[model samples]
Target: MNRWFAATTAAALTGLSVIASPAAAAQNCGGPDEPAAIRFAFAQLPFEPLTGAKWDPTPVASNYDPCATLSTILVTVEGATGSSPVQALMFHHGEFVGTGTAKAHGFTSLDADASSDDTVVLTYKTPDESTVRYRWHDDRVVMLDPAPSAE
Candidate 1:
């Protein structure tokens, strides 16, 4: 009687496993936003490419100023020893906004040496017009519209 009971329990467990298999699982990963894609004009360097970079756009409350809100972005990339031309990250927000590169300013250019651990700084006028600048800081890439100057 014990042997028969054990066999019956095993069969029931096997049936449950089959019902809970991945083949019967749902497809969606669990979120509204799709995974972002990263593309570079040049080849990717060592380490890992910037994957979990985040951006936050400030909410526009009342006045209809052209540039009301601001956006903050941040990401980290690997370093390269020798000089190699490199560019990365194509940002798409509602429209194909633009691409940001690690430019060492007056030094060589975006296509000169890879700027590792450099935070790409961008100032957006209205999420449309913007400037992409790179720096050697591992902080947030704060994008803000220039404040009005005193008359």
Candidate 2:
């Protein structure tokens, strides 16, 4: 084997192994809004606060865990600008935790299941629009539905 070829192949294989390995645990994992993170655990996200005119908050998840001290609440806030649009925020124990992808649309109706520990599934109904389900993990609320076609 050529000397340079063997060295290059060994280096390439070593790099591939590193890429395939799991990332090291974070000391403090931030929420989904932590910005451009490739990996984050669910427990890192707590509820976030939301404030706006014409906004309404309902504790859909709390219904299932009514007796618990901490509950998940969903808030629908009217957008302040075109770029901002409407915002769907989730809170726990009155503290801001996270936001949903329901931006630009008001989520007037909400339902959630709090049975599973460390996870909550929230569904929202928009007036005359497609409904969306957001999976609430420790760090973020992810939209389960496929986005509407731009066409």
Please name the candidate that would achieve the greatest lDDT relative to the true structure.
2
Superposition error at 18 for model 1 (Å)? 24
In angstroms, how far off is 89's CA in candidate 2?
1.9
**Candidate 1 ranges with C-alpha deviation above 4 Å:** 1-36, 39-81, 94-97, 101-151
lDDT (10s digit) by residue, model 2, range 1-151 = 6999999999999888775543311111222221112112123432223433554233222322222222244433333332222444443323345555534243333444432433444443433355555555555555566642221
TM-score quality measure for candidate 2? 0.34
Tens digit of lDDT per residue, candidate 1, span 5-96? 99999999998987665433212222112122122211232333343222212211111111112111222333332222223332222111
Q: Give the Å shift of residue 111 in candidate 2.
A: 1.4
Off by over 4 Å in 2: 1-71, 76-86, 92-95, 102-104, 113-129, 147-151
RMSD of each: 16.3, 16.0
